[model samples]
Target: MPCPERHVIILGSTGSIGTQTIDIIERLNQRGYAFSVVGLAAGKNVERLAEQIKRYHPYAVCIGKETEGEILRQRFPKVRVFTGEKGLRELARLDEVDLIVNALVGAIGLPPTLDGLSLGRTVALANKESLVVGGELVTKFLSEYGGAILPIDSEHNAIFQCLRAGRLSEVRRVILTASGGPFLRVHKEELDRVRPEEALCHPNWAMGSRVTIDSATMVNKGFEVIEAHFLFHLPYERISIIIHPDSVIHSFVEYHDGSLLAELASPDMRIPIQYALTYPKRVETGLPRLDLEKISRMEFETLDHEHFPAFATVLKAAKQGGTSPAVINAADEVLVERFLEGGIPFTGIASGLQTILSRWESAEANLKEISSDAGNQDEVILSTLLAADRWARKAARYLSF
Candidate 1:
């Protein structure tokens, strides 16, 4: 019997996760899985986007700028092209798309996620910001529209697989493992002097600049904790993070009966990416297998809050709920950029987050009386979060360390 084709639209198509998704799709197709790239979207990477379009020949595509979209249209006249943030949402809501692979970075990825779920499309999500910033809204959409989100992140993907071992009620707690990045052994007093080049050198995984820096500060791990809370419907207390320097065991699920289930694989994004695409049906990936014999040893350590102050700050905001997480995420995005540009010291990221979050909390307290009586609840929530996001970005830019 011939297999039905699964049509996929990949946002952030030129990014690390996005490119690996394309690789997995092509590999799947070769293995008798009918996976087709129906659409591709990228931000400001016209050269790479053009190459992907030429190779895969998606029916429609989207780019960050109108000028780039025009260039693409001239090159491939028959292919439909959409532009900007609105274009991303349009691509997500396309009727023919079976899977919406949101590999886009930062808060910009949240809206398309909501749009895709609004029509009940299954989202293969690599955008942690979507859950970190708008988790409540995302959960509401899932409940109301019956959409699904399959995590593409390594930690969450491992948890998703380990969760199959037992019922949700029977689970004791979920553990998210962190690689601790390049600063694991650095003394707290010296973090302020560490250069951006030092933080970017992640030992385990190849990722984007922002994410790599986040890993160094352990802010990425904090984001994962928030993501896990939403993905597993677990309380903040039930989700714990352990510093596993080896990056061997992605995550662990503990059962009430004192048994632990873990998903182990090599540190490859392709493993999780492939799992998200062919969920409930495993297939050969043609990638190198995890050789535990060669690895020999794995070590785990407790997360030192003093060493990674950003992680602690992020979690505090997450606990505060409402627009707090959005503010912190937006602020961190700006701060990371500033640090990479040599404008701010490495320690400035955490201290800046603390300052901005305190200011946001103070300002939010003043606006407590304001009520959203006009629009839909979701609209009100989305607007509120976006407003906080904007405020944080502006605040972070002018903030002096």
Candidate 2:
């Protein structure tokens, strides 16, 4: 049987990585490649999405917000657009989408990722929540159905690349490098003094709001650690984070024989996106090539858990296993949003999470307890997460006074 033309569905297309993926898609199309866009999704960037619709017309498009979807429908009557979680799932599981690029940020990206992989599609996952929230379940599903994940996140992408030449049994450890966000040098005592604008201004890579904040707390890297654990099928101890401010060398994998392989490149999202899109066959993505001469001093340091408590929280949760990590992820998402809203102090993110876990307790850990299917446990935990988030916000807001 002849292979179908390479069709891709890009979720969160209006965001940083999504926009770059579209740029790569346009380049691929211009070169008379078989790849075409099947689905596109964004939050509120209907105007640019309309431009995307006019250029490389997608078969399906989704807007997660209703007002945006309504506006988009009124504007582009010819295009088929969807809204909300159901629509996101439709776009994810579409048979036309040979591969799904999940660039959406936060926990919202979790459902579609689960749906995409569950349906046996190759998931190019940029979203960390899928692994952070549903790691065990996703792992079990992938094991059963045989779906492949092409890590679009640079750190995971690096580990994925390094492991290509070596076996897991021979692997000693996976060292995931981080940019250390904009606050690598900021003292822990001063974290509470940071404003939203300062936090948003990332020193290295340009990205969405939530992730930028996550980077500062080191929660983003922590999420990546849990993700690497599931993606590489290694224990939390085997997955480590190193602060590399240069962001040139993405990650490193050390073999049992003391040999460490590293993947180096400029902090370019297109490289990884293109790699997943073309996989095995390297495609030309009109992006600027990385120059080692231009980047002179690439340094690495140990992550300061004393300063960034969120990293320690995720690692501890990962050690607990089962529903604990999921709870940690969900609570953190809520707390971050609250902090962004001036509801909680910056340091309260870890505090809120710690409170939730302390209440959930170690002996109480179970996947079914946190899942939406289990009667009131889901509602209880979710409500508690939101409540804790609200409490954190209150604490943060009061702290301002």
Candidate 3:
């Protein structure tokens, strides 16, 4: 039997992933794919959001800020309006949406994700931070709600596709490939001198400013470590990142008997986005098809911990699991934003996280002891964790250049 038309709710629809998703939807619409747009949102790209609405005609749109929402409402008075972060949540929770694609970046993506999953919508997640900060919450949500959390990130999507080749019991390990960003060639000692422009110039992919900086700092890769841990339910030690200059091989899975499986394709977001969209069925995409002949070389190097300390930071946080990864993520996001604003050097991203980790460790907080909230999970979930985040940001700001 054919699946019914799927209704999509897209958050951050004007951002890189969101815009590419809309592009995919346009192609799918032309090809008779059975899907309708229900909701779409972004952070102040009102003009582009309006263009998306004119094309997809979603029932609602969110701009992630009140002023922008007000302006959009005035521009299109007939469309149902949603304003600010809460409005984003309301849009995510809408009943008509069959699937929600979360494209918002950073920790800000968390609440809408929770709202979407709580409403039992199938979620295609491009926002890896959601899993990084709240992996346990995400797992519990899936267990309780039975909503599928499909990955839209290329690496995780590759792992998702590779896992299909065999059973989980046979799986041994997963290797997430990274292009290593713009600084892969920069000497270890030269990192202290890296400027914002150099860090933002990603060699392989075009992304938002924050993620671009995260990629250069490898904090993005660190977040992906936690993401893979939750998405595949693998141990942190078993989940590894390889610095592959060519991102052709997205990710790989190894079986217990030593058989290896890999997912390879051109570095394209539409492929993974479409995979999550029309899951269990592949579709024709206008993306450049992978050409093996021209790409005659594939190389992999171990992630240089000596150069990128963020890699070790993630491993430490993962080992000290519970709210520690969330804290690390919250701090890194804040610090990365500062670095991008020219308040700090590129190396400050890791230094800042390290400072916060030491500060919290010395403070009256024990992440493992506080996991289940022997006394206040709600407070941990909201206040303590938030305070930890704020405290980390303040420390980073003060210590940073």
Candidate 4:
């Protein structure tokens, strides 16, 4: 009798979480954890991906663009190289992979996620957009397909660990902790004047630009609120967000029995990434442990929805349920990119979502009907969501002016 090595396929293999996952796997292998890299996928970072393939020696590699795939195919002739969205789907459904680490950003992460789960593979999910855009569809698919999703986001991962202390029924409230980004203290007038460089300078965590900008607007936390609602089967009332500038207490879950449980660790992405890979069984990663005494004090502030209007928009979208979240998520994504490109002012991010949402409601009230009428058929639901997403992105771009 011997332990089997877990074969992993990492989507977005060149991004922040994907790179950290690779680092953890290498670290864990040194500590005698049996794991293998069977496949790797990235967007357009062929050079870094090529470096990864040489080091890890995966059997399959896929890129978003066919041109990059051709280059990779020539370089690694012995390895299987795939191209485009179809290739990413093919990579997820590969027969050899046991775990699919979907660290891919944006709504594009949704399809391969559904593919992996349909095949009954463990999905280590770092893509919050998957849940944010298609939470109902994802839950329905999981109910039918019988796979597992381990949260790789620090906040959700912490809440997941905290919820284990008590029965789900006994949980009263789950509090999500935010670092408040870099503008926690900026006055309202100054917010509109903040530049992309200032927004990208997150106070606590290092992440991709899209996510960093989302953090500045508190929309990242808003999406987390929706994510928690679906992941834990908790109502919006039970989910709360607080500004924890220290970034030590990742999240907290309060029980009905007057007990609160929290998960605290250094704001290291690798910790959650490693935990998601080897869940129900912790392994040594050789990272620094949390030093409690060195932490002088922890402060928590109530989220000022007025300051970050994106939070209010997320709350409204989550409550509305049908295609509302998809519209808002798409709008937010476009606006974040526009802000980064200096095409819009900082305040335009929130205003863009509001305008797009209003226009969507006016143009296609039936979209919500379609979403709500789709029932449990995953295909129909997903199609409706995709249509809504496309419409929102187009509308948001128009509203950006």
Candidate 5:
């Protein structure tokens, strides 16, 4: 008997994880896996999107830039091309798509994620901000709508794999390992002097500029902690971060019985992406396998909270429920952009986030009034999150650090 086919849509089809997902799809199709892409969504990468369309022959496509969307519509007359975030949501809600590979960055990924989950489609989530901004809402949707969130982040994916070994109650702690980024050895005082290019040069993983920079400051790990809290249903205290410079052990779960289960790979994003897309079944990826004998040793260090203030800031926001996480995520995105564009120094990222959170805290009374009401409808809650996100971006942009 033939396996049932999965109809997929790559939401951020031009980015790193998106392209790698397409690669996995192509390879799996050749390996007797029943997988097909029915749609693709990209942001202003008409050429790359066109190439993807030509290869996969998806029925629908979307682009962020209206002119680029038009160009695609003209080029691929047979395929439907939707424009902007609306278009992205359109792709997500399509009845034919069985899975949504949400590889988009930032808060833009949140809406499409909600839409897909609401429509009972499993969302392969690579975007951390979706959980960071609205973990409560996303989880609620899962319970009500009967869909699953398969994490595509390597560390979270690792933890997911580890969790399978025992019952939820038997798991004591989940430890996420970080690559320590490119500036792991650099002194804290010298972080401000580091150039954007220097910070972007991650020692272990090749990723988008924003994520790479976040990893340098260990902010990405903090985001992962919050994500772990939501995905695994663990407390913030049980979710911990350790600096593992080797990048080999993606993550681990310590069981109540004093045993630790870990997942190790060769720092490849496709490994976890593949696992998320094709759950309960493992396929031959033809990638390099781990050879522990050749490797001498793996090192683990404590997270230097003092050096990476953004790490502490994210922890603080995650500890404070409601709209605080959304605010911090929005501010971090803006600060990362400013740093990348040479408008702010590397150290300015943490300082700016601290200042924004402080301002919001000072006006907590009014901000709480604007934050999501637990009893409200999902759409209303979503609106409140977006409102908070917008306010934080504006506050972070104009604030001096």
Candidate 6:
């Protein structure tokens, strides 16, 4: 019997994860696993998207700008082209698309994720914001629509694997390993003077600019903690983070019996990407294998909450359990962009998040008396989160560090 071809739509096709996912799909095809790219979506990287379209010949594609969509349509007249967030949703709901690889960054990724899951399509998710900002909505979709979410992030993917060692009832706690970014040794006081280039210099991973800076601030790790909570159905207290500079051990799950099951791999995003694509059946990735014998040292440290205050602030919003996470995510996105543009100091990222979150909390407290319930209507939840996101971005712009 021939292998069944799995149809896939990749959001963020020009991104680091999206390109790597394409590479994995090609490799899988060569290895007897049938996978086809049916749709691709990208934001502002038309040149790379064009190359991918030329190679893959996707059935449909989406771009951020309408002008660029016109260019793509003229270039590839046969391919259906769509633009902006609506395009993302259209590509996600494409008929016969077996999987939606959501590698999109920021809250923009959330709506398409909800769309894919609502249609009962499997989603290989790299966008942590989907869970961070809309975990409740995503959870509702999964329960009602009978879809699956395969985590593509290293830590959550690792925990997803380790959880198979025992049942969820048998689990005690899950430990997420962090690489401590490029500034583990830098003093807290010196962080305000740090440059964007310096902050983006990750020691273990090659990721997009936003993610690299989030890792430096350890905000990315906090996002993972929230992601794991939703993915594994574990409470926030049961999920933990630790600094492991080696990036060798991805994550760990501890059983009630005190046994710890860990997923270890060399620091490669493609490894988790492949696992997500091929899940339950490991295939040859041709990527470099982890050789534990060569360098025999692995160090672990407790996360310094004092040094990386942004992580704690994010967690605080996550604990608030409403639109707070959306606010934090949106504010961070704006603040990080400002930092990268040299408009704010490195420490401004954390300070700015603090200001926005504090304002959100105060506003929410005041509105609690008159706030009407929105119930669980998906559209209402989406609109509410989008409102919070817009408000945060606006607030972050006017914020002074």
Candidate 1 residue runs with Cα over 4 Å from true position: 365-374
- TM-score for all models, in order of appearance: 0.98, 0.88, 0.93, 0.96, 0.96, 0.97
> Residue by residue across 290-370, what tens digits does model 3's lDDT show?
999999799999888888898788768877876677678878888888887878777888888887777767753554344
Give a tens-digit lDDT track for model 5, residues 1-401.
Answer: 77689899999999999999998988888887888899999887889999999988999999998888888888999999999988988989987888899999998899999999998789999999999999999999999999899999999999899888899999989999988898888998898899999998988889987889889888888899989999999999898788899999999999999999999998989999999877978878796788999789999999888888899998899999788889999999999998988899999999998888888777656755665565658877888888889989998788776
Over the full model, what C-alpha lDDT does candidate 1 score relative to the true structure? Answer: 0.93
Q: Over the full model, what C-alpha lDDT does candidate 4 score relative to the true structure?
A: 0.90
- At residue 137, candidate 3 shows an lDDT of 81
Candidate 5 lDDT at 74 equals 87
By lDDT, who's the top model here? 1
Query: Residue 263, candidate 4: how far off, in angstroms?
Result: 0.4
Ranking by lDDT: 1, 6, 4, 5, 3, 2
Q: Candidate 5: give its CA RMSD in angstroms.
A: 1.8
lDDT of 4 by residue, 67-170 (tens): 88989988999999998878888999999788999999898889999999898888999999999999998898799899989999999999998877889999
lDDT of 6 by residue, 1-401 (tens): 76799999999989999999998998889888888899999999999999999999899999999999999999999999999999999989889999999999999999999999999989999999999999999999999999999999999999999988799999999999999999999988899899999998999899999999999998898899899989999999999888999999999999999999999998899999999999888988698899989868999999999999999999999999899999999999999999999999998999899888999977764444433466656786787888788889999998986
Each model's Cα RMSD: 1.4, 4.0, 2.6, 2.0, 1.8, 1.8
Candidate 4 residue 315 C-alpha distance from true site, Å: 1.3
TM-score of 4: 0.96
What ranking emerges by TM-score with the best candidate at the front? Answer: 1, 6, 5, 4, 3, 2
Clashes of each: 0, 4, 0, 0, 0, 0
